[model samples]
Structures are given as C-alpha cells and as structure tokens.
Target: MVSSAGFPDFTRVVSKTIHAVVNVKNFSKKYSNQFDPFDFFFGFPDDFGNNRERKPQRNDIPGLHGSGVILSPDGYIVTNNHVIKDAEKIEITLNDQRTYKAKLIGTDPSTDIALLKINEKNLPFIYFSDSNKVQVGEWVLAIGNPFDLNSTVTAGIISAKNRSLGILRGETQSSIESFFQTDAAVNPGNSGGALINTNGELIGINTAISSASGNFIGYSFAAPSNLVAKVIQDIKKYGTVQRAYLGVKGIDLSKTEYLKVYNQETHQNIKSQQGFLIGEVFEKSGADDAGLKKGDIIKSIDGKPIQNIADLSFIVGTKHPGDKIRVIIIRNKQKKIFNVILKDLQGRKKIRTKEEITPSELLGAVFDPLSKESKKDLGIDYGIKIKEIRTGRLSAIGLEEGDIILSINGIKMKNPNDVNKVLKKYSGDVTIKSIKENGQVYIAGFEMN
Candidate 1:
C-alpha cells in the first residue's frame, strides 16, 4: 500500500500482524560465566574481539529477552531454539500486556526452531504464507522486540535467498541453513520475530543478523516459513522432527577448491561448476538402492534445480522419511532420473513413534559430542556434554546442563549413540562419572531396574 505522498505505507500490515508478535524472556539458573555454549552471540564468539571486561557478578541473573510469533489462537508460539535453550522458565508477553508461562513443546536445533504452548484462547495469530513463493526485491516488514523495545517494526526488501552461513549446530551435524537474506532491521532481541509481507502473511522468522557488533548492520537472515511449519507439525504430532536423510556425502562444486579436488581425486575431467558432486554414497541407503553411484553430479531434485549444498539441504530437509523423491543427476555427461525413497538416520522407511525413543532420549536431555578444544581444556579424552536438561532422570537427580558425561557404567562415552548402546543392554546398577562446567568432578550411581 502507498500513502498519499507516494511512499510505501506498511500501516495496514503492521496493524494486522503486530498483535501476534510477542516478547519471549528466558530465565536461566545463575552460574559462573565461563564460556557457555548458549550465551554466545548468534553462534559466534562471546566477545567478538571487543575486549570487553570479564568481571564476576552477583549470583542472581536477569532473564534474557527475545521475540516470538503466535501461530494459533490456543497459544501455539514459534521461536528460535537458541532463544530458550537451557532455560529453566519461559515467559511470554502478548502485545496487549497480557503474560503467561509457556511450556516447551519440542525443539529442532537443525533449523534453530522451537515450539511452545500456553493455556490461552482467543489470542491473535499470524497467517503463514508460502515461503517458496517469496521473491527477492519484495518489500517485507520485520516485527519483533529489539533491545527490549516492544512491538517494534521495521521495513525493508528481500535481498537474497537460499543462503547458508554455517552457524547452526544440529545433533546430526546436518544443519538446515537456507535463510532469506533481507535488509530488514533485525537485532539481538528479534531472534524469533515474524517477517511478514505487505498482506500481513508471515513469510519467515527473524533468526540472525550478520553483524560483528551483534546488532543489525545491512543484512539479516530468517528461517523460511515453510520449513518452520513442517518442523512444528512434526514436533506436535510425533514429539520429534522426522528428519530425512539422502545418505550421501558430497562437496559443493561451485567452489573452485572443491571442484579441483573432486576432479583430481576421481581422475575425471568434469566441467560442471554449480552442482553437488557426490563423494561417497552410503551402503544400503536410498541413493545406493536407486543405483546412484559415486562421481555423479546431482543437477536437480523433484524438478527443482540444485545450485549448491544449501539448495539441496533445504529441499530434502523439509521432507519426511519414506517419502520418495525424483532425483536427476548427470553421470558421464548423460542425464539420469532416479526414484529415490528417502530414509531416516536409522535407515527406516517409516515414521518413528514416541515410544521408540532410545534410552538416552528417555532421560530428557540433549547430548552433544564434546569438541576437541573442550576435551583438552577439561583434561578428558572422551565425553559428551549435556546440552539441555529437561524433566527426566538427569534433572530429577540434580544434574545440571553443561555437565560432561565422561563414562557410563565403565564404558567411555565416545558418541551420542554410545549412551544408547550401553543403557539398552544393561538393566542393573548404573554409574556415571562426569565433570561439571566449573571443572569439578562428579560421580553418581543409581539402580536402573
């Protein structure tokens, strides 16, 4: 809409959508500020070379604030997972000054999305638009709380799409990062806000801003609304994201270095410059079952052109396991079409049930493999860090987040799967040795059966 002065006016869109944008505050337990994974700045280092002072403060810590978008009248809200990570209490405040405590439904760190629920009805909600239909150079309004300012809205145009920044860290290490790059003014407190079109339809969720100063510069990124909807639906119905995997590893050929390496290693003179070159095809995977071999360049999937890794990851990340996808690849300069049935990480072709959760999952905690730097700093060779603590055995036993799991029942915790392998077979006594985030050693023993 344009005003009488011939300028684009977003007053109507703001009035319709701003009511659904909300303030999300996360309250965490007090602890020493010693390199918290959740306390970093948009997945970057904490200080960012600013040479900020590091001083000890009081034990009580104030709640951190962000933004959220209401998706349903019954109080289903969506926000970035990092906003509420490791939070003990989540508070939601509506635009009309109403507040309520929120319950965490589920989280998918791969896409950096989280679902929350509150007991409220007749609440205002935003409508979701097809993000695939969003085009560049289109006007968009960013609605969120920036610097604790409530109901703030900024307007800009979509600058780019399908951008991957390698910021998100998922459990499977295959993070979905197809972001809508915009010139909208998104900031630290706008992590989970809404990005709506002129029609007041939500096209994306404001996630991260590419700024060394930890504020809005010239560009910002948002998670596409289509991907967010699929993730939330899976979380609400299945208690987890039904992540599908094509079971192949490759390098983006658009880069000069990767292209050179592929041609030299395979002794092939391939000249394609913008397709994903297959490095290894896992055995018994959907790609292998469909006769997709190594050295094939994937040109397209389901008729959509594959330009790079971001294009491929975003397309497949939205699909569920057991879904068949049409894949077109160029092998020896000949186009080949293959009907590939996607599978889960477990190699299953069916939907997974909540009851099928592994023993480690039943503990109500998320575990990430400790980094090499962290291992060396803690003087431990192998351990898994407790990323988040929910309501379960670990939390009930007073185990806090950021505690390292060195070993369980005398078996070294090398990978996340190791916890499941050990606990599933033993039913007697259980013992866990670990180190706290403060460098204190802790050991606990309990009966399993």
Candidate 2:
C-alpha cells in the first residue's frame, strides 16, 4: 500500500491524516468499588454504600491511553465516549509534541462519540467524507497510538459496509452500530483513531475489533464519519445529543430472532422475504403519532430502502428532534408513507437551553413506561424501564443501565417523568425498587446528589 505512479497514492493521505491523530489520556482518582448488584452496568460498582472504613486505593484510572482526531482549527477534538468516560482529567498530545489539557464538551454514549475542546488555536484538523459514498473494498488507512506507539499507521481495504456488532449497547441504550468493517490492524489504544480514505478525507473513527485474543483478528469496525460529524454538530449546538427516535421495537425480517416476534404478533408461520417488521411501538412517539402500528413492515425511509436496523439508524440517527422524516410502511398488503416529526426521548419538541438545564437533564438516561405485556411478564403493575444510561447522577448512583425502576420510595413509578421529577426535587437518600436484566427484583438506596 505504498505510493506509486498511475494509481491512488496513499502516501498523500498518510501525510495529511497523521498530523490530526493524537494520543489521549484519561485520569481518575476514584477507588474501584467491589459490588455487582447488576453485572452489566458497572465494570466495578460505582458505590459501596455509606461505609467509609476502607483504605485508600490507587487511582481507578491512570495513564489510560487512547486516540483522538482533531475536528477544527480551534481545538475541537472527537474521540470515543469510552475513551473519556468517568475521566477526572483529560490530556491531549499533538504530533508536534505539544501537550494540553482537554475540556470535555459533551458525549453521545449511544453513538460512542465524545467531543472535547482545548484552548489552543490554529491546530491541524481533518475533513469528513460522505461515508455513504465509501464502497466496500476501498483503500483505507487506520491511524492511532496503538499499544502506546504514537503515530502508527496500518493499511487495509474496507471489508464490508453497514456492519452491526452490538458493541455500543452497554454504553447507550439507543445503540447505533452502522459500522464500516475493515481488515486494518487495530488494537488497544486505537479506540478513537482516524479511518481515512486515499483522498485524505476522514471516513470513520476506528472504534472496535472482533478478536478472540484481545487483539485485531483481521476484522475491525469503525463509526462512520458521517454519523460522527452529525454527533459533533449536535454537541456543539445542544449541550447533549438530541437523538431523534422512531420509537418501535422489532426485528429484521431476515434474522431468526424475528420468528418469536412474528409468532407472538401475527401467530403465523415465519414467512417474510424483506422489510423490517414492528413488534411494539412506544406511546406518543413519532412512530405511534404517525399511525405506525405493530403489524406494519417498514419499506423505506426518505426513499432510501430500509434493509435492516443499521440502515434505519444511518438515516434517522443523523436527524435531530423536531425534524421531519418520511416513513414508508406496508400494512395489511397496502403500502403507505407517513410524514413523521421526530421527537426527543421525552416525546417533546423543546430543546434544552443552557439556562434551563437541570440535574434531570444532566442525568444521561432514557426512561420508557413499561408496556402491558412487559408488566404482565415481569409480574409488575407499574414501573419504568431505563432504556439506556450514558453518564450523570443516575449513573453515579449505580442505577444499572437498562434496569427497570419499579418504585421510588415505595411509591409506584408509572413513567419516565416520575423518575426525573423525583431526582430533580429530592436531594437526600432515595430508595428505588427495580428489576435487573437477570429477572431479579431488588431495592437500592442512594443519595440524589
């Protein structure tokens, strides 16, 4: 993959992208807690009750290394959310050996993207290319500080397009995993590195790899640059990600997972060649408001064919709240298109302003009311399911992501607002009854602040 005459020379690309790739360090001093009420959310528990008799431990995170890509000359940098999650301090080292502390602007854990800013100006940055236009088998380069080796470059061809590895589920409930798969030799410390084309345009962010031995195994994935660009724009415009939702839970028609849904809903034999079928729709959501029913099959979005969840995410994930989307669906052997105005998770159109921001807004989580079928299955009449948890007070309180909140201080929790309103108003010990992913019900108490 060297530069040569009469061909796409990658040397020009390496020269342009290498300057924007930088090393990232996450510093934290909190001691790791030894608890696992819910095994998934906390790598280690965030809290261990009010006991203060334990001895001080070393920093939970120190000298943790990763990679970042510069997005602007004014020092705006983009990296993976996991790279900076729970970081007490962040440091960025440029290729020229200049180091500066970075300010975390905001993060979209759903997309596994984070935006950081530094005080420096006139910094080298990279331009984003239309990831949609990137074809499979295109020449690409992965640049990062892999294995603490700064300014490392690896070359490969894009092996596949629109890949979903279910990597983002743990960080954000609304996982968007439309990744571009590559054979580049990515490894540890390459989480937020740049994936660029031969033209020197950023095509994706090198994120994760599929390896059985904890290293690259000829397969890797990257968050598309188009989505990263949209995430960056949202962080700059809104304080947090203004994720617009289609609000329906279903399965891809081609997968075996859709059989259970098909049996339960239609009670018919598994038979479908194409189109995504809806199993349930959230109330008051754009899909529900647009008259999209559970039995409907999604045909396309904005004239683009919807082949799978990744395709759906690529289109809707880039849109903001209050934006209108045209959804084409097939219902009872009829094709229909509905113009739907996407709304925030709260089913509202208002965006949070700086002055109006509150702790609830800072609570990076999404809450959905328990469906009747869900309540019946869980043997709970009232509760709210936490769809996802990014960061904020809820996460600090050890509220495991995706756990259901059954009650607040012995009061039945009905909807998302109840959890938000209580967390916003109460400042003391709050007891919560909830259901875990393992179907175990338990009670937890923690301070609101």
Candidate 3:
C-alpha cells in the first residue's frame, strides 16, 4: 500500500507558478488601408469590402495583450518578442491586480525573448531550473494569461527536447533553438510566460504549440532555459546576441544522401561514420582563414565529433568571436588539422567597429554609393539600393531583389560608401530601415561582432 501523504502535492506548485505569471497589455497602432496586390489588381476597395464608414479607421489605436514571467526580484520580466514588438506603451498587471508601466530593455527575435523592466523593485520571481537536467517524463507546469484570462496555471509533463519545428519570425533560418516540448496547454496570449518544473523552478519559456485548429492539440514547445539565459545575458550586456558562426556552409546528411555516399568513398581513413562535409567557404571567413576548403570533410570540432550540419552549427553557436578552436578535417583520404578563429555571421573579427563588410567579398550584391536621385525617390536623405541579394545576411533577412536602404541604426544613408562607413561604426545589433517597391517601410536588425 502506498501512502498518499508521501507523494508530492502539485497544488502548492500551481499556486507558486501562478504568482510568477503576469498580464502584459500593450498599445499597438493598427494600420488600416494596407496595400494588397491581389485586391489592387482586382480593383477592390482598400478595406476589402469591410464597411469602412461603420468601422474605425485603420490608423486607430489597438489594444494588444499578452503574458510574461517575473524573472528577477527587481521587477525584471521576460516575454515574447512578438508580444511586445512595436508596442507604443506596455503595462504589466500582477497577480494581485496591481498594474504598472513597463519599459522594454531589449529584444532578441531569434529566440523570441524580450526583457522588460518595471518601476517597482523587490518583486517576487521564479528561479530557473537546469533545463538540461530535466527528463522527458518529469512533471511540469505552464503559467500564463491565456485569452486575456489572468494567471492561469496548467499541468503536464516534458514531452520532448531539442525540437526544431521551424516556426519562427522572419524568413531567415536562425540558429537559436533548443526547445523543450511539453503537453501543457498554451495559447496565443501565453507567449513570454513561464514553464516550470515540479519544484516550481522555471525550466523553459512557453513559446509555441502545434495544432491544426489553432488550439492546443497535445503538443507545445518552450525555449529551453539554457538558450534563454544566453539571449537574456547577451541582450542585457550588448543589446543583442553575440552569436558565433562556423563560416562553412554544409547540408545535413539526413537531408542529403549523396553526402553520405561521398563520405564513405572519399574518406576511408576517417573513423567516424557521420560528420559534416565542407561546402563553399566564404572568402576571408574564419573557416577559410583556418585553412578549411570545400573538399575537406569536418571530422571533429574542439574534440567533439561532428555528426551533421546541425551539430556543426550547434557547436559553432556555442563559441564566441576571436575564440580559437581546433578542427579535424579529412581531405583526399588524409587526415589534417586546422586552427581557426571564430567570427560573427557578418564575418567580422572584432567587436568595436560598426563597419562590417569586406568590400572585395560583398557576397553577391551590387551596391553603389548613395545617389541624390536614389535618396529623393525613396523619400529619404540617405540609403543604398539593394540591386541584388545574394546568399548572406542581407538575403537571409528577406531583403529581396530590389529593396532600398533608408537608414542604419537611425542614421541617414548617403550612398553605398555611406552605408558601409556607418555600418562599420557599430559593433552589436544594427537595424536597417528600408522601403520596398510598393513604398512599404520595413526594418531588419542583425547582430555583428
């Protein structure tokens, strides 16, 4: 016979988790009359048959609501980037129904984490658990304000980890994910909240749930605490993440069977059954500088055997720029060694300068100095016209074939030379404001070392 008293009571855990959940309400500007190509070609009204006279104008203010978790004793909160993105005003409500204005400290969309600060201090916060130690069947709790409901607490167990479902903002493939999948119910307003373990320790941040009907269908994912800690620390110190780059492009063996066959035929000396094949290395990149070539098969990095492209990317992301690492490569049935210094995605070596381009290796883009005609037509005093977007940071950010740069970090662009000069002056995340062909303005920010 089992004693019920010896069993852990989850009721207390739920109560504590609820206390950490917060209500985040923000004011967002709703842009009405947004241009639609389909509607334009068919000659439909800008509102798309909505009763414009009866409805409020498009530029009217809209109330945006979401959830968050108290991360510190001094009123520091963490939430989703999409939840508070472009918010005009942010107000936080506590478990006691007390409200206070919150200020955005920093945001990293790569991991969908945002840091916010409230006016008050000595607030109650939940401590983060070691997510790496959490097992798949361990009990967990999710706390958030879902569907405008305040401080809701749901219970479940860890379902999976290291999940990469490819549901992230922006079109580019980002390298910030190690999700802890859970069965806890999560919804739209639950973003930026807490996912806790049995002991009331935060293990992950509730992010996304997979469903066909736009509701929880027994699958949910949270950003693991390890990655969340990195993003939070980076955003606090540098206003952006200092992501490390490996500089070599490759495909995963699971995705490409030819690479597997090539590995068996070319590298007989290599003992490993799986590793990354070196594709094209960027000129002057860290890998190229380290003597890595296109034909070399990466056997190991820093003593860890490379299993696939994801393994390579994960290992590279764990390093920082200027850190020297040893790479083992098998080339032409011969083993070799290469010492490489890691670089940022932009291929920069240092963190002090804002200019981040090797002019000779611009990576397939036709850039010209800012011209008077370009600036006048774009309705900006400065910016460069992106004539083409080859494969690199620019192309990754959805800067298609003909986007025009308006500014970098709020500075006006004068030309390509001006863009380069201004870009080199900053070292962390740089926001590029540009206009599309349809005259719609969009901003893309990238981190440079």
* Candidate of highest lDDT: 1
Question: Can you tell me which runs of candidate 1 are displaced by over 4 Å?
Answer: 30-60, 170-172, 264-267, 362-449
Q: What is the lDDT of residue 332 in candidate 1?
A: 86
Give the alpha carbon lDDT tens digit for every residue of 18-105 in model 3: 8778998866443334432212112324355652232323321435577898888889899877676546567899999999987766
Candidate 2 — what's its lDDT? 0.78
Which of 2 and 3 is ahead in TM-score? 2
- Ten contiguous residues with the weakest lDDT in model 2: 36-45
Could you tally the backbone clashes for each prediction? 0, 0, 15
Q: How far is candidate 3 from the true structure (C-alpha RMSD, Å)?
A: 8.2
Q: Tell me how far candidate 2 lies from the true structure as C-alpha RMSD in angstroms.
A: 9.4
Candidate 3, superposed: residue stretches over 4 Å from native: 1-8, 30-63, 169-173, 256-277, 291-315, 324-340, 349-370, 374-437, 440-449
| Candidate 2 lDDT over residue span 1-449, tens digit each | 44456655677778888999999988754344442211221122236634323354444446467899999999999998777765666889999889998877777777778888888888889999999899988889999998879999998999998876666675557888899999989987898999999888899998887764557778878999989999888667755667788889887875766666667767676566566888899999989998999878898998888887788888888988788999899888899989988888878765666446564565666788889999898877888988866654355334666788888877788988886566655555566677877676655443333
- Model 3 scores worst on lDDT over the 10 consecutive residues at 35-44
Candidate with the larger TM-score of 1 and 3: 1
lDDT of 1 by residue, 1-449 (tens): 79999989999889998999999988665343444333334445545544344464322154578899999999999998878765656889999889998877777778888888889999999989999999999999999999989999999999999998777752226688899999988888998999999999999999888765667778998999999999989887866778888988898877778788777877877775878989899999989999999888999999999998889999999999999999999998899999999998669998877667666764557899999999888777899999976533454233678999999988999888888889874565567787876787766544342
Give the whole-model CA lDDT for all candidates, comma-separated.
0.82, 0.78, 0.69
